[model samples]
Each structure stands twice: as structure tokens, then as C-alpha cells.
Target: MWGGDRLDNYVEQLRKERGLNQEEFAKAIRVSRQTVSAIENGKYNPSLDLAFIISDFFGKTIEEIFIYKGGADK
Candidate 1:
């Protein structure tokens, strides 16, 4: 297992910037609100496929949306 959360994302910020709440953003990305919440709270590390989906939804690159700190950034 991993030591801690090493992945973080700006999903909440980006969603808010677009004026979309969790539910709306989840709909846009074809995810559940719980999934969006989990990602925003740093409790989940999405698979590569989901990462790409998020990047595509935001018109951003995977690296732009997901930050890999090498270790727990919490």
C-alpha cells in the first residue's frame, strides 16, 4: 500500500471556476458526486483513464489537473 495520499487535484477549484457544483461537474465528467468529492478531498487516486477523462473535460492536460508530489502532500 501507499504511505499516504501522494496525489492531489484542483478539481474543486476548476469546477467552481466554471460555476459548476459537485453534482453538475460530476455529470459533466460522467462520475458521481461522491467520486468528485473523494477526489477533491484527496481521499482517492483516480485511474489513468479517469485522469484522462478529467483532463479532457477541463481542456487541460493530466499533469495540469493532477499533481504528483512523490509522497503525501497532506
Candidate 2:
């Protein structure tokens, strides 16, 4: 699971389920493929606008996409 509950794997899964490659999905969401790749690799934290775009693209809420693991849980 990429990034665990941080949403990277969720995005990857969603992208695959939609039969979208990184380039295609990135174009659909108006972001560079590198940005999408970075997000999936957990090398980037998406801006609020980008996050919303991703959520909307996947038909999921922000919380459903990005889950924050609190220190207490660790």
C-alpha cells in the first residue's frame, strides 16, 4: 500500500480501476503526469485545489482520499 492510509494507493487503485494510465489520468485532472506520479510515490503533498480535483475525479470525498494518521495511533 503506497503511503499506507495517506491516499497514494487509493489513487493508484482508482486509476487502475478506471483503466487510466498516469498520463491520461493526469490530463483528465489537468495536472502533469509527474505530479500524479509524485503523489502516488508520496513525494509530494497535493495542494488543496489539486486534492479537490483528485477527489472529484474519483467521486470520493477528501477525507476518503487522504487519511491522516495521528501520532496517538502510532
Candidate 3:
């Protein structure tokens, strides 16, 4: 299982704060808008490199943007 729900991010909020739409944000980060949507929706987990890119884009640490909820049911 992917355990996507275990991962959380502030991508959408941050992007909006920066006045960037999904397509614009995706282009800035070299990913498809669909990928950005998935990240925001918690339907997909990004690779470490992409995560680093996103963190850098937001001027935040990876931990500040993406939070791991850990294994299911403790």
C-alpha cells in the first residue's frame, strides 16, 4: 500500500499564498500540474528530490511542509 494518507503537505496553501496556480507552480518546479494536484490531495507521495525542490520553493524545511503521520493504527 502506498499509505498516501500518512503524508501531509502545505503545498496548496503555500502556492496560493504565493499567487501561483497549479500549472504555474508545477512549471516552476518542473512537474506536471497533475502531480502537484496529487501532492496537495494526498493521493501521491513525491520523491525525495521533488520534496527538496518543493521545500526550497516554499522557503521551508521538508518537515515544515510535509508531515508524516506514521504507520497505521500505531
Best by TM-score: 3
Sort by lDDT, top down from the best: 3, 1, 2
Give candidate 2's error at residue 16 in angstroms: 0.7
lDDT of 2: 0.80
- TM-score of every candidate relative to the true structure: 0.87, 0.81, 0.90
Per-residue lDDT over 1-74 for candidate 1, one digit per residue giving the tens place of the 0 to 100 score? 32236777898899899999999989888988998888888878777898899999999999999888885435
How well is each residue in 1-74 modelled by candidate 2, as lDDT tens digits? 22334434368878999999999999999999998998887777788898899999999998888766645345
Q: Per-residue CA lDDT of candidate 3, range 1-74, in tens?
A: 44267888889999999999999999999999999998898888999999999999999999999999888765
Distance from true position, residue 14, model 2, in Å?
0.8
In model 3, residue pairs whose N, Cα or C atoms come closer than 3 Å (at least 3 residues apart or on different chains), thus clashing, are none
Error of 3 at 38 (Å): 0.7
Candidates' C-alpha lDDT? 0.84, 0.80, 0.92
Evaluated at residue 37, the lDDT of candidate 1 is: 89
> In order, how many clashes per candidate?
0, 0, 0
- In terms of lDDT, the best-performing candidate is 3
